[model samples]
Target: MVLVWAAASLAPGAEARQSAFDTRASHAVIMDYETGAILFSKNGEEPMPPASMSKLMTALMAFEALEDGRLTLDAELPVSETAWRRGGAASGSSTMFLEVNSRATVEDLLQGIIVQSGNDACIVIAEALGGTEENFSAMMTERARELGLESATFANSTGWPDPEHRISAADLARLAQIIIRDYPQYYSFYAQPVFTYNGIRQFNRNPLIGVMQGADGLKTGRTSEAGFGLTASAVRDGQRRIVVFNGMETERARADEAERLMRAAFTEFELVNLVEAGGGAGQVEVFLGQAETVALRAVEGLSFGVHRRDRAGVRAEIVYDGPLRAPVQAGDSVGRLEVTTPDGRIFSVPVEAAEDVNRQGLLGRAGTGLVRLIRGG
Candidate 1:
C-alpha cells in the first residue's frame, strides 16, 4: 500500500506499474512530495480537464503577486461585471454568489476561490494581476513550465469544460508542491474552514480537511467530463504524502481512497535518522587532512518502507571507492548507504559528508600518496 514511484532525477516514490492506478479514477496518481516520486499512476500523464485544480496554479500566481508587492491579503479588489456574470453558480460551474460592483479584498477573493471554488474569485484575481484572464492564463502557462509542469495548459481561470484545456495529475501534484514550497506564507490561508464574505459564510468543500488525519489543506475540482479531483496533501508522523485523483465517480470515494493510501504510507514506511549536521553516522578516511579521516552521517533521517519481519536483514553498507580527497564540500556526496531487508527488498539513500575538509595542496597529496604506497609495499 506504500506509494510506488516512477524514477526521476530528484523525485521519490515507487517504480511504475501499468495497473497500479487501476482505481475507479480514469486518471490518477499518488506521489511522495519531497522526492518528486510517482508512487502510483494510471493514465497519470494524460492531459485531461483539471476542473478547479487549475486553481492551484492560480493560487501560485497570487502568491507570487504577494511576494512582489502587487497583491496582499489585506489589499482590496473589485469584482468585475464580467467575472461575476461568468462565474459564481453551481452545477459545476463558477458560483460564489458574487455581486457585481462589490469590493473584495485579495484575501476575500482568495477564500472564495480556494474554499468556495468561486469562478468570480478566479477571474477577479486574474484581472487584478494580469489585467485580463487571457494574459493571466499566459502567465499561468509560463509559470507551469517554470515549475516543471511539462504537461499542463490553461484555457480559463476556472477549470470548466473545454477541449483544449487539460492537465495531468502528475502536473497537479507538482503544482501543489510548488505552491506549498515556494509560497509558505500565502499557503496558510488554504487551511481555513469557513470563509465569510458579503454577510455569507461558506465552509470548505474539500473532504480531506477536518476528516482525514493530518489533512490540512489543498484544492478540489469537478465537471461532467473532468469528474471529481483533488490535489491533496497530508503529513503523518512527520512524513508528507500527496495525491492527485481524477475521474472519480463520487466525491467521497476520492476522499476514502486518498485516506487509505495515506494510512498505508504512514504505517508501511519508517523514517530512519542518519547523520546530523556536523555529526557522523559513520566515518571514511580523509586523505591529507589534519586527521586521518572525517566522519559522515545522515543529513536528516533515512526513513523508508521496510516490512516488519524484514527488519532483521535491514543492513546498511557505507560505500566509497577509497579515501576522499581534501577540500570536500560539507554536504558533498561521498557515498551511498544501501539498505536491504530479509525479503531482499532494497532501498538506497545518499550519504553526505558531515563536515568540510579542505584539500591539502600538492605537497599534502604527495605526502598522503607516499604513505599509502609505503603501506601497500
Candidate 2:
C-alpha cells in the first residue's frame, strides 16, 4: 500500500501574496548564489548581445590559466598592431593606452580588462593564450560549453559586435556564480575601482560598486546593439545574490534597475529549507516485524527560493510504499518527500529508513496472522 501525509506548514510571519514583479529590462535574472536557485527571470534565456559583459569569460580563462601554472600574473604579454589599432586609444573605444609592441604583465592586463574594460587588454590576453583572437574565441566557446554556459557563444575576445557572439542573461548569472565559487583569489579583481596605465586612468564601468550596499564585483556592458547591461553580485547578512539584466534604454536606467532588482532579491525572497537531511520524513507500517512502524528520514535537505508573500502556499508531502517487509535495514530507500511552492514548482527528496526493524519470531508472526485473519478474511 502507498501512504501520503503532509509534512510542512506555512513559514512564520508570511503575508498575503503580492503582485508579480514588473521591470523595464528586456532580459533579466536574479539568483541566490548559495543555493543556485533562480529568484526571478524575464526573457532570461533568450540569446542576446553580451557586449563587454562577456569579458567575464575572458577573465575566467585567465584565472584558470593562473591556477594550473599555464600563465603567471607577473608574466608580460605583447600588444600587437591589431590590438592597439582596433581596441586602443585610436579606436575610440575602451583601452589601456598600450603603445603598439609594448608589453604588460598579466596582472596589469587583468586590471585593465576588469577595471578599465580595456579592449586592448582583452586582445593581448587572447593572442597570448590562443595565438590569435579567432582561435581564442573558438576556445572560449568550447570552454563555455564545458562550464555549462549553454547560451554562451564567442566570436571575439573583446565582445565587439558580431552576429555570432551571443549570451543570455541567465548564462551570465551562472558564469558569475562559477567565478565567485571557484576562483575567489582572482574574483577580487572585479571589485577594483580604477586602473591606470601609460599615463591614463579609467574608472570601473560597473555602476553598482559604491551606490548599492554590499555590491562588490561584476562587469557592465553597453553597445548600440546590446543596450546597457550589467552582471553583478551582492551579499547581505551572509547571503549572496547574482543579478543579470540588459536591454535598458540608458546607463542611468541600468543603474537604477540593477539597484532595484538587487534590493528586491535580498528583501522579497528567501532561501527556505523545507526539509532537513536525516530528519524524520514519516512513519511506515511494518509487516510481520518486531516493531509496528519504521521511521523514515530524508536522505538530503531540500531548499529553494520563495517569495516572502508566497510562503503561505509552500507545501511538503511524504510519500511511501507502506507495510515494508522486515528485516528493514537503516538507510534503506523507503520513499520521497515532495514539495510544491506557490509557483507550482515541485521538488522531491528521497527518504530512507531511519533505523533497523527486524522480523518477528515465528510465534509472533503466527499470532499477528491469526488476528488479521479473524478481523478480515
Q: Report the number of the highest-lDDT candidate.
A: 2
TM-score of each: 0.67, 0.77
Instruction: Tell me the tens digit of each residue's lDDT in model 1 across 1-377.
Output: 11122112212332222231136778776667786655555677888899998988887888888889988789988888888778865334656678889888887788888888888899999999889998988888888888788888898888877887788987898888877778777777777788877778788878878888788779988888888777788887677877788888787887777676556555644333333344445667776776666667655545443333333334556667667767676788877655443333345666688777787878877887898799992
Distance from true location, Cα of 93 in model 1, Å:
2.6
> Tens digits of per-residue lDDT for model 2 on 284-329?
8888899999988989998877777767766666677766888999
Q: How far in Å is the alpha carbon of 263 misplaced in model 2?
A: 1.8
Q: Which run of 10 residues does model 1 get worst, by summed lDDT?
A: 1-10
Clashing pairs in 2: none
